[model samples]
Target: MRVFRILAVAFAAITSLSAAPASAQFFLKPADLSGPRVTGNEPGILGQTLTGATQTELDAALVWNLRAALNVAALQCRFAPSLFTREYYNSMLEDHAEELAKAYKTLGGYFERTSENKKQGVTAFDQYGTRLYSGFSTVGGQLSFCQVASDIGKEVLFSPRGSIDRIAHERMYELRRSLLAWGDQAYRGYFALAIPRLPNFNDDCWDESEYRAKRCGDFFASNDSKSG
Candidate 1:
């Protein structure tokens, strides 16, 4: 009976090994840990769904919002170290606010300028604005971690060589990770909106710095002969 059980187990193991594909060997390969690619659609938004819209429409919406969300998140993460010092935090907050405001203004300009572009219109801007709001809400969510850190930091003031300091450090890292994750999700949704349609459009047509400038230029040039 013991010999029969051993044979059965060996047969099952052999069958499982034979059924496994060569591709399975590389299934757990490590990803490249380098920073995200700047030119293509950001990774986070690659396969997201926009609740009420068709895939194409959502893709267009993602182009504008995803980039903005990434920029905001990057800036916030860069500013986070300053939060440890009151004076530095105040300075960083001023700088952070200015940078964010500039990004918001730039986004607003894109929306106003591209309101009539055939590929993406005012609706894209509205969708992008909604994404910005969502990203900001996530920023607010990190405050809970900050509060915990603050509490621990205060407790450790009396006994500076205790476990409370370690706990505070762990909480800070957790807060930072949470902020980054939220930003990535927001950007992912934005990329989903843009990447599918980017190939069909010319670089001139979708210039981020000068919204719809190429389309407007092409339209005028095409109409010049008619006016003449």
Candidate 2:
């Protein structure tokens, strides 16, 4: 009988362990993300395009887009320092400076080639930089944006130099998608905000602005009881 009881307890422990919940995570996994792979020509992803941009120019745009996204994360997502997006961005600047510089130069050249004059080219390049940063700014989707950017930033840190563009190409689409708000996947529809129902303050429930407890009856009584 003692042996049977011990075996039953062990079986229950194993069953409980097997049924344990999945680990909690704040951010969506990469496989869970939505959006198409960035081909660099998408106006939605790049913000604006230089007319007649070649493949090299397009790749440069993608690299700059990724940089701007991470920069935004560094500035805006600092609230969660543990994510270290700012650190990642700073390190990326040092580690991939050559590739990033080349991308910037390439993009500047594209603008210069497309614009009418040097002055206009400079203006166009400046505007592109401004728009690039602004495009990633978000209030409603801050949580999701920061989370996705944090993941991408860590990945960027691990990525080999000169391969930043490849990471940009692979993740930029998902980064853009993160700008839209996404709720907790596990409890998405299970939760609803509870608003306390206020007591009616109509004339029927009051007499000459004095609350008539008798008129209100059990409503206040129940609430008072709950409070007590």
Q: Lowest summed lDDT over 10 consecutive residues: which window, candidate 1?
A: 23-32
User: Can you write out model 2's per-residue Cα lDDT over 1-228, one digit (the tens) per residue?
Assistant: 334533543464456455653221354432256566788888677887667999899999999999999999999987766556786787788778999999999999999999999899999999989988998999867877887887788777766777998888898889988887666665544552222334667779877866777767656566665454
Best candidate, lDDT-wise?
2
True lDDT of residue 122, candidate 2: 91
| Model 2 stretches astray by more than 4 angstroms | 1-31, 192-228
Query: lDDT tens digits, residues 99-167, model 1?
Result: 434444554455556466734645775675665546433543353333322232333222222232233
Worst 10 residues of 2 by lDDT: 22-31
- What TM-score would every model get versus the actual structure? 0.26, 0.70
lDDT of each: 0.37, 0.77
